[model samples]
Target: MSGSGLSSLAAAMESAVQDAPGVRVQTDVLIRAATAIDHSGPGSPDWRARVAGAIEELVAAGLVECPRTKAGWDRRTLPELPHWVRRSAPPVAAPRMTAKPWHHLLHWVPTVDSERRLSSAERGLLDAVNRWLPAADQVPVVPMRERSWGLLGDDKALEKLRSGRLFVPGRLTLELLRCRSTWPPVQQRVLGAGTWLIVENWSTFESLCTAAEADGFDGRIIFGSGNQVGTRLAALADKGDTPASPVLYFGDIDVGGIRAARLAVTTAQGAGWPAIRPCRPLYELALASPHRLRVQPASADTVSWTTAWIAGELGQQVAMCLTRGEAVRQEAVGLEILGPAPFAALVADV
Candidate 1:
């Protein structure tokens, strides 16, 4: 291997070790990660030989240590590298609420077929719900509209499937507090409690619903559905059935999240619902979470309105996330943190 190529391999190994001190990775993984930035194209047999030689150089330089496994060349271990600071430990896998209790809510969520397995995003949504629904629940639902189907970007035909009568049975519906829905009665009470929990992502929404119900939360829950939250929030605000209830929104810690929450509140205000705001407790937990991912930094407009609702330090964290392009996903908060007991304590005043 050339000196520069060896140096580049060493840097990638160092990064992997720093990202996860004791993790194991396949040779392909290391090769792919290295070549991603190198743009030299994944090498062939001669290239593979060069990679192996580079690994030996790293070992010789005392910068990386790899132990052979039964998997042979397929896998290697990286015991923490020298002079590398370990990233924060990953959050424990949060306990997921059982699906038995929320099967009705899964009616509109799609499933895999014989030809293809669930994609990462689909699995992500189902995983949030703990994959407990019947095999029938795995069947894909036709999207009723371009907007309803936008979340599943992979289905090129989803837009074409938009129509009434034919899509009504397959359409997803949200059960609201004190408002009757034409939707099935079984799915009507996803949350029996009166709390209005507006959640961002589908997985987070499903997980929060399961967590809330498990914790005996009787409140109603709504999916923010990305930027579409304003419409949902406005609808709730316009409801005369229930007195304006305190709505607690939980979303990712990023520019989009802040903007979504702000838009929801502004939309609610326009419809005369008491101004909704961020759930501070959730924000505090997100800020301290270990599962944060980096993105492009948040802009001034993203954090401007949200700053008023968040504490000084929390606001600073939001600003920093925007500046550093970091994000704390709502999933990081876990069912235990989002359960009724903590949720109640968090919004008791509201």
Candidate 2:
């Protein structure tokens, strides 16, 4: 056998692909196996270059074919792999245990990109959690300070932690530090005496802020910043010395909005807040608004469980929208919908 690292890697790649059913091998599968025997750092540039080079060599030699797409490599139809290399022993087959709770949690969390690539800190946190998950009596806790390498100060990691992932409790020890010098020049209103309201759309957020300020309502509005809510909202709602107050989420009447509401409530509840719910009046208004568009439903494929968690009327409306394949934008409500009086009326009893 050749002594070159690429030679051994190529051989292992061939053997693994040959042993696999249908001669199919995913990029991650090959890279992971190569990492086990290749003796390279997990995400080092040199290691990635070596893997890429070996893959390209295999493609050139007609041993593998990775079709290209406009976006990137198309792994779906990766061509048949050749069985040209020999291995000393067959790959081990282990009994498949039921998926651990963390496995399902990861599916719900947005830790990785479309390519399933994690950042250095995210990978560190995930690996550490995997090691301690089985032995964890309760939620496995990690300090957020610069104690060791893990996803602590990382915003995305904290957001995911707040999403009710029980085995990995990173949100408890996390504190987001803000320096006046490094701030992004965005000014957020400080609440004097009010409940926190998370607004998903930028336009709606601005309108609500204006309305709340003018109406003299005791409601503090925070922007959810689209799909990635980040850690600011969670920090304000969960980490402060102020008393925990009710949380109300107001977004579009579409599936996306419902999902956002669900995430907001779950994160708040996980942080120990007791009263978190969607603004019933705003949600109902969107559902019943006559300004609905005929656009295709964004999340029509799967029925969501948000209906069970929200108020009966609002939840039933969300369920009805899904069943009828309807999506209502927040713009349907317009700026006038949540004017001072209406906004005050929305949360008056809560």
Candidate 3:
């Protein structure tokens, strides 16, 4: 066969394989396609020999594979063709290279973009960081949202800084960003006290505050404002004026409440403070109360941890309550249930 004829036959086979549903093409289909080419007439006896030669060339070049059987080619006679041929592995493209704006941010660049270029939002963030880093020392401490709004024109831009999505430089610390946690409202009964009590619900907080104001409770009383306690627990460390205390948490006896308490414990420990523990007396009071609300069943881990935290009969009861998809809100144990000197009485017991 002429060089152009051989090339045409090979091209036909390639097109047949490409047009097929999958990588593999039947040997007869490829041969039929090659025979259809202008160089090889369908009625010609030597067309199979030409097709077989072209297929061998493609197989030798690694353009296709014959997994079932190898072709045995002979110039004198028609070559043996395999049952099927499959397209070979495609070449892998090299990673796109782009110039980095800062050497320090080499690892921080996102790889999602095909062009290896920063998006408009990312560029804006980098620009803000550049402006802030040069004069970071000169600026006074500000709220995170305030700083975020001023720099990125979006108050929530820096919300994910600690979430690992954004790569902030080691030098550009949260302290420098001044992203302080919003400390919950507190009612202090004792001056320079180390022990503190945190209540979750608003009504419960008000009840606790009333108790604290009446000298019914020692130490300080804080309003956790629900699950926000987990994130804001770090503020206890930020407020240097306050003494490190054994923080006690009281909240709803539900999945969210338990998770929040767990989160607060982890966050407090991470901040070098003592682990937050449950306000046992308050929880027991709430559990025993007639008031009960339907709640989603908690996971085994949550139930197990709640049992472990409370311990013994009370723990088992709490676990059973959780299993039954029932919860006792902290509001159930209000001033009426707790009495005016509830914390003082509990303190005496301790």
Best model per TM-score: 3
lDDT of 1 at 165: 22
Model 2 Cα lDDT, one tens digit per residue, 143-259: 433223343545345335434332345322232211111112222554456776767888877777777777777756777765545344455544352335666777876667767
Better of 1 and 3 by lDDT: 3
- TM-scores of the candidates in the order shown: 0.44, 0.48, 0.52
lDDT of 3 by residue, 1-350 (tens): 34544477787887788788988778888878876765435566545445555676677567797654224222122233456788988755544435555434333443433444544555566567765666677887887778888888898676534433344354345685655545454433342264677677878878777766566454776667667775455565556534465678888899888877877776676566765777777877888798788978775446546765655566667777786789888878888876644455543313
- By TM-score, the candidates rank as 3, 2, 1
Candidate 3 wrongly placed segments (more than 4 Å): 1-142, 146-170, 174-192, 241-243, 340-342, 345-350
lDDT of 1 at 281: 72
Weakest lDDT window of 10 consecutive positions for candidate 2: 175-184
Model 2 alpha-carbon drift over 4 Å, by segment: 1-187, 237-243, 295-304, 340-342
C-alpha lDDT values of all predictions: 0.53, 0.53, 0.65
Encode model 1's per-residue lDDT on 137-233: one tens digit a residue.
4444432232233334443332222221213354322211111212111111245547676788887777666766666766777888768786565
**RMSD to the hidden true structure, all candidates:** 20.0, 18.8, 23.9
Model 3 is weakest, by summed lDDT over 10 consecutive residues, at 69-78
